[model samples]
Target: MAAEAQSEGGLVFHPLDQFKIYSLFGENPIQWYTPTNVTLWMALAVFCIVGLFVFGTRGRSVIPTRVQSVAELADGFIYKMVEDVAGCEGVKYFPYIFTVFLFILFSNFLGLIPGSFTPTSHIAVTAILGFGVFICVTVLGFVLNGAHFLGLFWMKDAPLVLRPIIAVIELISYFVRPVSHSIRLAGNIMAGHAVIKVFAAFAPMILISGIGIVVTPVSVLAITAIYGLEVLVAFIQAYVFTILTCVYLKDALHPAH
Candidate 1:
């Protein structure tokens, strides 16, 4: 969800077209070091996160300023989430989880801007993140619990005959985790942006058609509502993703039950 593209049509009606990635420098082919909308937006998101959490609250005053208060609130909230969901040992990884939440949250909010890109809306970005977590937790499980980590897929408490079958199903489900995780976030971000674009297309109709009096207001109102909901969804999805990571971490730390 980066960079704007023009349409051959009189007015570009393609809502999904905003997601395309092109080189920021020139029309040359993309390479490993090539700068694109995705990289720009992701870097911007990181900058925003650091600015808010680090510089914004650097003072740590007795009576906090607005930015300080917000930074503290976010820090405390994610800290509690990690403690509660992943337990004591998980606190060691709080920094990693917290960084993930901030990056996604910042990207989601920044994408709301008129001409900004949303890296979080792309599957390529989200898939890497999801798979990274999956790998971390799986490897952590094996390292921490040794051969006992395989017990996660073993339904020992199940009926004798169904145990083996259940293990296979569990194994498949385990592998599928990253796919669902990546799609859920990317799908939601893309869908919301597309819906907004669709509603926005109607705004120009007011000047083109005489009957736009009714259509324009309806479209504007719908856009406003959806935009507000998208704001909420941005936070909710970030929180959901973070908390689910904590849950998976817990599973890795304690695969016995």
Candidate 2:
């Protein structure tokens, strides 16, 4: 904790520092085209998705291998989700929803590794995803339903005096969907990673200092508990995001529903 020791001892925590974006290569200024940790992890996620789903399932058999079985299971799960939430018509966009879920799920799991970046933790990434859903659904609604899409905002069932207020509230909530959607994913992802990092910072203290013995076990236990929870959260967040997307698509496809 002294000026000389810097990060050496006495519970000097730097949890958020783990989320810093930087290039893997060196200490150079990043450019628009610069390949950073985010790009690396995103590409790795994509690679894993393809390798597991594509190559792993290439050999179709009467009795499926473990990898093929997993691929098939995931496919079936999301396929059913789209159909149930967005209806049979929404099944056409299965590939998009599946890819989004896979990428986020993989990004989250990869981040649990000792030295890995989580692309989904960044607002920039999540915002793009959130806004993309917003824009896509909004456009699809307009395209499919034309002016009738505005019925989503109008609350005809409400009393005559309250219908205008309800419409206004619904319109605002609809427009705010992207912001809320993006923050939900990014906040959940960032908070979990930051908690793990905080616990991990304490583990190093025991190796060189007297206070480590007490802190190390606690840190390890906390990390393990949170890590296991994060595993569940990873899938849940992916599922929530995808299911919500399906719901929005349903609204777009059938605004009155």
Best TM-score goes to which candidate? 2
Q: What lDDT does model 1 reach?
A: 0.89
Model 1 lDDT, residue 219, Cα: 91
Q: Which parts of model 1 are misplaced by more than 4 Å? A: 1-11
Q: Hey, what RMSD does candidate 2 come out at?
A: 2.2
For candidate 2, write residues 95-141 as lDDT tens digits.
99998899889998888787788999999999999999999999999
What lDDT would each prediction earn against the true structure? 0.89, 0.89
Can you list the residue pairs that collide in candidate 1? none
Question: lDDT by residue for model 1 over 1-257, one digit each (tens)?
Answer: 12242322223466887898989998999998999998899889889888888899999899998999999999999999999999999999999999899988999999988767889999998998899999999999999999999999898899989999999999999999999988889999999999999888877667766777998899999999999999999889889889989999999999988
Q: What is the Cα-based TM-score of model 2?
A: 0.93
Where model 2 places Cα greater than 4 Å from the true spot, the runs are 1-9, 205-212
